[model samples]
Target chain A: MILPPPEPQTRRQLLRGAAARTASAALAAAAAPGAGGVAPASAAVAVPAASATIDRLQRLVRVELLLEYCYRQVLSSTILRPDARRAIAPFEGHVEAHVAALEARLAARGATLPPGPASVSQANRFLARRRVGGRLGHLRGDQDALRLLLSMEQVVIGAHFVALLKLSEPALVELSAQIMATGAQHDAVLRLLLPPHKLGSAAPYGLVQGVQ
Target chain B: MVGDGGGASRRALLGAAAVAGLALSGCGATAAPASTRPAPAVAERDLALLLAALELERRTVAAYVAGLPLLPRALRGTVQQFLSEELEHTGELISLVRSVGGRVPARPNSFQLGHPSDAAGVLALVHELESAQIATYLSTIPQLSPGPVRAAVASILTVDAQHVSLIRLQQGQAPVPSAFVTGAE
Candidate 1:
């Protein structure tokens, strides 16, 4: 998280370094018995560490927290009915499971363990008050409450895309890409639920490098 | 060494491990602990902003999962996919917070804002949340760390931008604007 910035160098430097490896890999692939281009022997290329593995894992965890907070806020907003709350049950369960899994990973990395189920509800409250209503491609509909939900989701989907681009860790970019992809689907679903005018609002505003 | 401009925020410390636990599990998708070694010197402001951003995502994931069943089957697939993405983002954030040696929040039973049972309500809430996400990221990018973190914030902002467009189109807002929070930066 606190890596010192590497000295700025030209893209040429990286490309030159990559070129050597790429050639070696190409040779190895060709030499492999029965290896085909379709299979691309040694196809597993080394991506930039920033865009590769570790950072991807890290971003995945951070984005999870963002989503959790968003949902908690929406839940507390009180615009939904009982049935809606019931529908939300699965998400809550999912969040809990996510917390457990993420914690386990941190344990593996020799990192510190964050809070557990003990404080999940507090995250929910954080969501409640944090409203993004007055800002951004603000849309309206017959159902005011529904509009609110859609807007909240829009912001989340966008946040993922941001992580994907900024993280230099290759792993993190991959992870962010995955998350961004899911956000696209969420944007779609939310659109369908919203009123016509609000349906596709996720487009120009919601795309995360088109990771979807 | 860690400087005031580099210390991790409260949420970053608390959130990493928790998010790591959830993200790896996969809500189809989506905190921190202390250690023997010293923590990184992440900017406090960046840490705080990022912490909120991460928390926001957690809530969004939770809402999507809970809301999936409420929608008709057509929307279910989309909802699940989104849930998964949110999970991934959350997972990434957990590592970030811990790396900086900051405290993050744990799971919550109920968020302060109430939830909606109606499809329309859910959509509305989603839109608003996404908007906040976009603006927040934009606002923080400038002040975040000088390198990858700032870039990461911008990347997140891009995602928000895309989200805004999609939501706009989904809402039937023709001509989804080029930007959501233009001046956020």
Candidate 2:
């Protein structure tokens, strides 16, 4: 269940605590000798540009198919509660809608729709890595299923963010931006469902630029 | 959200350049005046986009200003958080305008937010505002040239979309509004 909203006094106290913490961090940073001498730098991995508009759309179509396929597999599991199934239904439906839109766009270009990946038979194959022991079935629990879905949403958001830059056609780029927005919404809601200790906030710090 | 303080002077020069361009176009000499020549389509398009984004962000900031007082204390924090983001967005857009040869736009004289009687009204208003912002950003992305400008707009657009989801959840509605976001306009 969603928690009740904090009281006004509680809100004020929380703000004060946050301010104090910020001040302490600032002071600590200032007092650290020679710390300012070192400069921090970060780099962004630029998403590769598609060869052509059709090529980009075709790649995105494959992504939607993969998402839909994963959602269908999770829905078929017996462990998911009825309410959980109900919630997931619309998400699956939305992915299908995305597939349709993408396919339509591809058809207009006389491009063939890309097939779904042959390897995405189960959730573990998608979620787990060999470096971390082995694949475990995350769909065995309702919470885990939600987490998987959240990760997919983030992946989609990152893809569209890149596509917006690569796409040459104005209308296609617009469509990508719109869909990316929805994907972000999905990310927010899914993040909220995870336990407070697991996922801290509804939104991320800056724009989510993830591609994988 | 802090700007580097150089944009104001640049924007002033841009405004002067625009005015000078217009004035030169009025001359009735035999040859076409320098101002009569159209600015590059790419540059003009970028300028228009920056202006539109500026207007959207400013109006949204105003929406929060008008709507927050009516909301319950519990809901105010969420709105405030969103407001801060919007303010950051406005700052970014202002810098972008100067970067793209556009002058600072006149701030909105008034926002069109309707009266809200309660917390629900405030949230509903927020939902509408966020949806509009999301749509605008989506539609605008295609028009932007591929580079930092487009990337910046997309980044802000994604955040607005997230805001829509959060607002829907508060209303006990499904988080996903639709399968695909369709930016009609």
Q: Which structure among the candidates has the greatest TM-score?
A: 2
Q: Write the residue-wise lDDT of candidate 1 on A11-72 in tens digits.
A: 33443345455556766876787865454333345434323433544444544554554456
Give the worst 10-residue stretch by lDDT in candidate 2 chain A: A42-51
lDDT of 1: 0.48
For model 2, the chain A TM-score is: 0.64
Residues B51-146 of candidate 1: C-alpha lDDT, one tens digit per residue: 888878766665555444446566555555555555555655555566677776765543433445455555666677767766565555555564
**CA displacement after TM-score superposition, residue B85 of candidate 2 (Å):** 1.9
Worst 10 residues of 1 chain A by lDDT: A133-142
Chain A TM-score of candidate 1 vs. true chain A: 0.44
Q: How well is candidate 1 docked (DockQ)?
A: 0.06
- Per-candidate TM equals 0.39, 0.68
Q: Give the Cα-based TM-score of candidate 1 against the true structure.
A: 0.39
Pairs in clash, predicted candidate 2 = none
